[model samples]
Target: MGDKLSLPLKPFRSRGGVKAPHRKHTAECESVVMPPPSEVLICMSQHIGVPCKPVVKPGDEVKVGQIVGDNDAFLSVPMHSSVSGRVKKIETVTMPNGSKVQAVRIESDGQMTPFEGIKPPKIETRDDFIKAVRDSGVVGLGGAGFPVHVKIGVERDKVDTLIINAAECEPYITADNREALENSWGVVSGIKAVMELMEIDRAIIGIENNKPNAIKVLNEVCREANRDMHGNVCVLPLKARYPQGAEKVLIKVCTGRVVPEGKLPADVGCVVMNIASIAFVSSYLKTGMPLVTKRITVDGSAVNRPQNVIVPIGTRIKDIIEFCGGYKCRPEKIIFGGPMMGLALPDDEMPLLKQNNAVLAFSEKEAARLEPSDCIRCGRCAAACPMGLTPPLISGLVAKGDAEGLADNGIMVCMECGCCAFACPANRPIVQNMRMGKSIVRSAKKK
Candidate 1:
């Protein structure tokens, strides 16, 4: 596969994605509102970097947008409450990965008052601009909640391109696309704000071709904005592909650059931000608003309705479902994220944090369980792997507990996109094994 022969090949079927029943009818039809929960658990280590230090002790009353956790570490960002509440306790809880970590527990007062320090700052200098982004505690809402300040404050000379990911590639995950369409002007304004803050002139918005309406709105907004928008903002239409929204894949498809193995996109003179993140930037810069709320797709097959919701962060999943007219059938499982990559929650009590983009409830029939069968040794997993690594080999080593072999086979590069798991005819839990393999390899490396 020469670069010339394979580079332009867009053979991927845009709609070949497996359809888990959509249980989102009740929720998606209505505008988003705050789903009141009795308690909210705020995680200190929600961001990728160091855990934030708790700013308030137990018995302290806190308002929404109040920074409950702050750290002096440059890599860490502060955590704010999504509701006005009394500090219940700071204790450890099991995260999605099944590891227990310290979390600040708050019992809601139901007042939902804004925090006193939620006002936005006047953006003047680049330093001031960066500070505003950091103070708001904004992260990538697409999925991975990487800190936003790190990108804004990056070495100016190292970055040459800014990529806005409007590619909501996952099926049923229309949060980003909807945000881009509804807030097109905001998206343009946000990017311009980023350009002013970073002094970078070249920015591109990469949207999947499936989202024609969003693409049109973005272009229209860019044309209307008079900030020398010519040639600076380019909307690249990517061929719709599962996992095409992955940072590296989007970077490759949009900019034709391969982020070198174990290297950040900044190393290749690029920084990628989600459309929602850009919207947040606009909100903070224009309205002086903190990141107190965001839009989410509250959908799945077991609901009476399906709709996107503008939800306050930290709302419990149960309340979200109830607000959507409750379950249509006995929801056997509730998953967060899209059907391809979302994690099945043990219970519906998990708080909707910055990282969660969708709250999916599925009936027993919708939550189809596949029995693991013998591997046919087919290379379909390899062909479907966007990273160009063989998943079967990784799964093999994982089955044999060959952590070293898994590492040698490039297990770390797997993004856990669930493409292999979705493609497997043998019904193997390829993604889970790859995740385990990556973890074991990481543990071994740490030693």
Candidate 2:
């Protein structure tokens, strides 16, 4: 009972998800420092909302943490230069989401000079706290890229619980796990700060039981703090399940509250944040460093050296792979994030963004797709869907171009966690179909 305590709370379970391979080759590897690249392609539209406008033009000199792009939109965050460099040009690049975004190209001077204005933000109130968070350019580093200030700026009275998602539930992505282990103090401090700012009394850090080390470290950190001063910051070990880190599922598991469809966690008196996002809050408050670099887990069957690496934002994927000892074999596919919901890259030239937690390179053997046979009607897809939607039926409707029918079947609610596809014996692309169905529904709504 020195540091660990076995709470009597039951482990929450979602409706369905497959027990895929963890393949966490770099779970034990401490994150290595990646050298800055010769050039960077910082995208202006890295976050979820409106794309930022470039404040600096070509030939303009910039320093690390200098705001290069910004937007007045409340839903957006500023983009900063990760390296001291001169602006090469601004060009259009296709993001993994298949949308074209403007990217500022910078030729690195290799000095890594911090902006002169960099200093800890003064925050005496909630508005100041939110301003500091926004100024730091923090976002959902767990791959969502949602602006953090906008997420936590909700009405304090509306949120009773704050859930820290430490459940690196996806296989092979250990960035979050490493953050929880090495940055335990930052994580805990961030939680306390958020609690004080938001007036939240209850906070839970949800880590999968598989990460016993991280769970232990976080719990120890919390235990060392004054419980009376910090309120309740509990590190709860969750069941190891796919999509366990999804906001809806996490809220359900951690608080035993269902985030209804067409609503948010705030609507249900909860706020969810990624572990890295929380840690960034603590780091930013101390150093005033914006979200310019990211911790990425570079691993897969084709990776020569599977390890976690901290890289500056806008570093090319090719450089990251090379820094990890290059590929042992040619990768047939490279994905950003985890196998469950990662976006497959058409090439490795894409630059890393703030939300990129992992870059996985898969060899042909691992990336090979199995020929999908006719549906066996085994109901495995339905059994594995966490949303309780019937994947097979929705997939059929999507194949038939029945957008209205797909909408009627709740296809838009699909998180595309790939649980159904992984559990399918027939190798059906249930998640892909669900994505198509969602797109179809969106188009229908637009029309």
Candidate 3:
């Protein structure tokens, strides 16, 4: 059955999982509060699919809710201003990866007013409802930023189940959990909206046991009368594991189905949506809010004060740092997302995007400073791989610039979950090599 496919064979000596210093309490105990910035920097390409085309040029006066960029791609969403301001410029800026991309710069007028018809579209049929959602530019808020419409757009005949990922398994990432706890109604409504759009009968909510309060809140909300969400909504308490919040891993843990490599959850007759995505969707259905901003965790040792903040999509990192009482020590490294799966920032110039989950500021002492050591041939990296790929072999191939050999080992499939890097006693940058291998393979393929 599909249930059987969801559970993976637990290895006798599993090596892919790593235990990093959580540093979650720095922000976990506090609630997310709004921290508006003086200016915003909306990146044209925030989602996974395609970048939005800038609609307004420099010097155009716009309100907070105005659409600044709109792409024709069905998988793309329009970008909006978080603060009422004038278009300062549309130029390329350094991103997290140190690559320059088209960015929309806006000078804030200090007013948070949305454009007219910011009201939710009155949708009748499911198709219209879905179209509106796509137009709203909503995507997975759990760091993927996958277009919401595309997720629910799978052929009706194929999908049999919808899964809601409440599994806040990533350390120092509690935005999704906080959303589910504080906005249970929104979460429930979002689930209903998704179910209604997909016309699916069964939906499963997977929450990690670590968040008992969130689990309790969701359970109580579902049990209420007239919600019409009881028999259909099944909440599952998942085993606490790092990377358990990943789409594939969560699917495996909750439904027992392996999302085929390079295929989507729909391939297995299922659709997965993040809890924050669901909450955002529910609000979109009511208020017609585009995917402009989201809750992000600002936690780490470098920060004097660490707390989650509801930030606009284009807010600068410097603003969040200042809001959190600024850094106690000069941050040697700033990472977006978690220390485990997050990409390190070459500089803080990269504006917040829909895919951004947590903004982690690490002190030089906290950040790993280990130099690469000779691989002990211990096979620890291979053991830790969640995708069942041999990372050690891939890393070795990459070490010698053997792109073909790396590709043959399926190095491209590596999610760069950092399991290999974390588990390596030699402190080898196994994931970095894997990433380079992928880039080399991609470039050669382009030839």
> Regarding TM-score, does 2 or 3 come out ahead?
2
- The candidate with the higher lDDT, 1 or 3, is 3
lDDT tens digits by residue: candidate 2, 418-439: 8888889999877778888998
* Candidate 1, 39-148: lDDT as tens digits: 78888876778888888999999898888898988887888887788998998767777866677888999888877766658878888988888888898878788888
Residues 32-64, model 3: lDDT tens digits: 566567889988888877788899999998876
Query: Candidate 3 has which clashing residue pairs, if any?
Result: 5-256, 5-257, 6-256, 6-257, 7-256, 15-384, 16-384
Q: Model 2: how far is 243 from its true place, Å?
A: 1.6
TM-score attained by model 3: 0.92
- Per TM-score, the best of the predicted structures is 2
Report the error of model 3 at residue 331, Å.
1.2
Which clashing pairs does model 2 show?
none
Top candidate by lDDT? 2
Per-model clash counts, in order, read: 16, 0, 7
RMSD of each: 4.3, 3.3, 3.2
